[model samples]
Target: MVENEKDLKDLETEQSALSEEETSEQHDAPSEKNESSELEEALGKIASLEAKAEEYETKLLRVQADFENYKRRARMDAEAAQKYRAQSLVSEILPALDNFERALKVEAADEQTKSLLQGMEMVHRQLVSALKAEGVEEIETVGKPFDPQFHQAVMQAEEEGYEPNTVIEEFQKGYKLKDRVIRPSMVKVSQ
Candidate 1:
């Protein structure tokens, strides 16, 4: 009876040890699975944050480029404004100059009138000089090629000793403020 009891107790001890090992292995497997899942979740979050950061960086670059372009355009506009500052005043003075020129072309009736006309001519010359200094210039029309940019053709005629589309006469003068045409020349073009 004593021998049988000893064998039974040994068997129970072995069974209990095996069960404990199995339980430990089960716990380790689940823990490992949990750790792997947590690691995968952390990696996914990191990837999402990196993508967001890249998107923000791209937007920032675009805004910076847009701001730079705006600044360049504003600077160019200011320069253009400064360059053409006297355009309005020059436009106003041109008609008066034309009237003065027409008055100078009239024949004087007496010596007193001729002397007065001479003085007027000198004043006109001085005014022309002042305008020249301010970058005001007259457009050439007669005998040159007719250009719509610089000349307005009021009449077209077929004339001798002139090429087709050539300027034959200037009825009214044109003026330019720098490179820009303030008024186009009135002209007769040969067809």
Candidate 2:
């Protein structure tokens, strides 16, 4: 009877040891589950941050392209202004230049003092040459096609030989600044 009781006590102790191991294992499983959930949350946050970074990169590239376009347009506008800067002043001086030329021609009757007239002529030519070099050209409408953009038809005439819409006379000279006409030529067109 004493040996049987001893064997039963040993069996109870072994059962208690196995129950303790199972309780500890249950506690470790919850900790592993918490670690896996935390790792998943961390990966989700990383992916969201990468997506935001990609959006910002696209916006930055668009802004850079817009700035470059603005700079190029500003440069072209400045160049065009510089090219036509002298247009207004030359138009204002043309009538005075014509008066000077007429006076020089009128004084040609005094043949003995021709040097003075010739000197004035040379100065006038220099002034005209300088204006021409800066892209100022006179619109030649006489005996050419009459264009509304460059010539103002003051009168229409029925001519025997000239074609219709052809300019037969230029009453007043016109001027152009490069491709742009500053003043339209006053002309007589044939119908």
lDDT per prediction?
0.84, 0.79
Candidates' TM-scores? 0.69, 0.71
The stretch of ten residues in a row with the least summed lDDT in candidate 2 is 24-33
Q: For residues 13-116, could you state the per-residue lDDT of candidate 2 as single tens digits?
A: 75576567547644643344577786775676568557656655764575566567767978999999999999889889889876886787664556766878
**Poorly placed runs, candidate 1 (over 4 Å):** 1-45
Candidate 2 lDDT score at position 106 = 64
* lDDT per residue as tens, model 1, 1-191: 35445644765675576567547644643344577796886686578667656755765675576667767988999988887787999899989989999999989999999999999999999998898888889999999999999999999999999999999999999998889999999999999
Q: Name the candidate that leads on TM-score.
A: 2
TM-score of 1: 0.69
